[model samples]
Target chain A: MTVDFNAIPLSQLSIGSSCRIGEIGLNGLLRRRIQDLGITPGTTVECLRRGPSGDPTAYVVRGTTIALRKEDAYQINVFPI
Target chain B: MSITTEKDFLQELNKEAETIRLSYVTKLGDRIIADIYKNAEQISKNVILNDTNKKNWTLKLDNYLTSKIFGYPFMLLVLGIILWITISGANLPSDMLATALFSLQEILSRGFLDLGAPAWLHGILVFGVFHSVAWVVSVMLPPMAIFFPLFTLLEDLGYLPRVAFNLDNLFKKAKTCGKQSLTMCMGFGCNAAGVVACRIIDSPRERLIAVLTNNFVPCNGRFPILIAIGTIFGVGALTGQLQALAVAGIITGVILIGVFVTFAVSWILSRSILKGEASSMVLELPPYRRPKIASVVYRSIIDRTIFVLKRAVSVAAPAGAIIWIVANTYIGEISILNHLAGWLNPFAQAIGMDGYILLAFILGLPANEIVFPILIMSYISSGTMIELESLAELRLLFIDHGWTWLTAVNVMLFTLLHWPCGTTLLTTHKETGSKKWTLAAFIIPTTVAFTVCFILTQTVRLLGLG
Candidate 1:
């Protein structure tokens, strides 16, 4: 079996980077919410900007701007496209 | 088990799915989304990049608005300018309306006397009901007229969604919806409407949280009190444009405190009994367009201004009659209003406000537009409502009642933080479909108001600053 270890958490992606979500590591309503916002695996998301606090970052997903806190973003695995 | 009936087979399948759901939601979600994308890619046409030429100037402007460095300052500047416009523009029209309405009240009183109507009948109909309505119109209409159109203009121009985008993070930290900010802005026009606006939030838990905390944003009714107190105590020393700017700035600061309380209470509720995880939101920042002035005027005036005014007047009329009766009817040597106020006085004083102010708040529950008038009436022991000509006269009225700067500050604070008016309570009840949640909404802000005022008063007194 081959292991692909280059995938990183969405929170680690820098501004202006476009990536496809690899895996969602959240559960239940939180997972459903992210998916509902079109941040599901295989969907392309572009990093917009961090908030003034820099913990919550905004990403443009499926033609809408969505904000994710660091903890939530960490649960989503993404790979640069 | 293999040859079971259809119902049993379905039940077994559901049990299987539930266990699988608990363990592999992440892997399952990834596979499903990947399959969806794969299917879409097969059916779609050639994709094009570099679509900037088709994007209009609105997108370029959005880049600045949603930019980290420029967004917060720009939001504040726009808000400050709107508030400044409201404060300065509302003055002349409010005074003119007051003069016009009061004169009409005098004429109506004289006409009733000439028509052989008894004094008590005249008092109940003209002085009680009519006076309250008059006060509501004079105090409320101008600000709403000015503020609502400006707010709607922003909404129409598509900046409001950007507001939701900017505040989304803070609200997410509080475990509520970012759309709550838009509803809170709606609250500035009318809290009942704001409570109704909670429908936009899809998550039921976050919607309830938004509904419960909407009262932290002061509505049009309370804005009169805030503006008056702000002008008198907050920035009264300044003159001309400086005074107006100072008042606007102070009101904005008070509003910021209200927003803080909203966040704090939301955070507490989300962590406590109403506990839940924050849900993600997909906010589409709509493109900016030129706001149509005609529709802006019509919608703001007809839909918001008149609609809110009508609701307030309906509640205020009955409240006025009750207030009149309370002020006129004596228990022992004191009028019932005074007796009630006196009963509440000790606690009120401990919070830096006197009994009459507290009593006014209690009686003014129907509509907050009349709290100021009721206070003035109680202070002068007038059986009917009264209005002074200017802020200076209003200041003297308060001073005569032993009010200090401490009282003024606390009154403004209490006014801003207290429970929703009667209409908002009803709206909450309807929205939540539970009496228990409505009761919680009422109790929460009232408790916060009392606690905040008590702490401020005690701290000031203990430090001998008051």
Candidate 2:
């Protein structure tokens, strides 16, 4: 697990940085949805860009861009790589 | 018990069961998903060589397209360019089509008369049905043919998911899914297709919200009307290329209004009858690929353009005949259309449109492409007997009927916000499979259209602009 002292919420990860997902705190639907899209523990996600309105930030996971809102991304714990 | 109360009871029961089932799914998903990926990765490792050195250009392009500063401007520019092309390209073909079809109509009428067809038959079939249907075909076919292909190309190129990413925040604020934006893009082609596209949304509540609010965006049927009005009222003084560009911008602004209203309406629904927490949004931005020219052309032209055209033509045929009957049949020297218009005038005028305009909208319920033609026919048969071709002439006709800028503005707004066409309503019913939701779909937009137009017209009239 990457859930050592370096863990932080995925939403706080800076743009252009990469991270490995430590733990997902979301329950039910969101957890299933994230996992369904290949976002599992130890998966690498690179922060790409934030949208114009800046609520949902896009990240590259498994070579695909997936957008996550702050509230949702806050539930995902990651370690900066 | 009442249906809604029964539904509430059912939902309450389902909530308990749903939580348990979902918990099981989540528990099962963790290990199951991990294993599947592990197996896939192992297989790929054994059988396939990984390409690590992908070119940076696609990545750089994605950054430019989705970056905070560049995202909106690029989206706007792309939309502007597409609309610019649709506007400029559609005009010449539409005029050519109009000329060709009207000539066909003349020949048809001549043959019908030579066959010694009754005057009423000639009137009903030739002047009535053929005229309006021709109007619909001429006006509708070109813009759709041009717009759908371009939209399909962008969609094929996978830019639409970026659009959803770009607008996800605004939609989230409305408590709806980001995928609603993608469906709204489909609505630009046709609302019926838009309703079907709502299936992309996983949550039932959000999907219904999307289907209901999809009509808020102007479809291809309403684009010409907006372009015409925007040209006349917005950039009336501008000439040539400048006029087209200004009209394109004006249209983009009007569509923006629709987007805002979508947020407002979606928010209202989520808070009210369709209340629920926003569902999981996992939008996949697939790597942009080169859109195949042959497939894009085939799908856009055949699947979208022809599909929508068939719906419009089938509806317009009967509607054109009904229009003829109503225009011809009179009580006390007033045609039924005029009577209906006059009856509707007080209410329509309250919302800044007049009798004939409102009547045309009602008749246009079947297919929106025929609304302007119906309005023109009503005006021409009631007032004069001139054949109108160009938007300039259409503007003169509206002005001739005492149309102010307020009327033009309200007409465009009403077109943007009115009820979906009949086929779309039927589609909503089929999709939702509930009469209540379909009825809700109809009532929500219609109510919004009236309220918004009423408020605007009253404010403008108070300002003495009318």
Q: How far out, in Å, is residue B362 in model 2?
A: 0.8
Task: Estimate how well candidate 1 is docked, as a DockQ score.
Answer: 0.41
lDDT string, candidate 1, B1-466, tens digits: 4656878989999999988886786666667866775765555535635344434566577678867788888888888889899988888898898899889998999999999998788888887788878878888888899999999999999899888877888898899888999999999998999999999998899999999999999999999999998898877688768888998898888898999999999999999978999876656655577899999999999999999889888888888888878888888888898888989999999999999999999888888888987887778764334556688888877787898899999999999999899889998999999999999999999999999999999999999999
How close to the true structure is residue A5 of candidate 1, measured as C-alpha lDDT? 90
Please give, for residues A1-81, the per-residue lDDT of candidate 2 as tens digits.
333888999999999999999889997667778888889988899998788788688888876678888888988999999
The lDDT of model 1 is: 0.85
Q: Model 1: runs farther than 4 Å from truth?
A: A1-6, A21-43, A61-64, B1-13, B17-59, B383-387
- Clashing residue pairs in candidate 1 are none
lDDT for each candidate structure = 0.85, 0.88
lDDT at position B398, candidate 1: 79
Taking chain A by itself, what TM-score does each prediction score?
Answer: 0.93, 0.94
RMSD in order of candidates: 4.2, 3.9
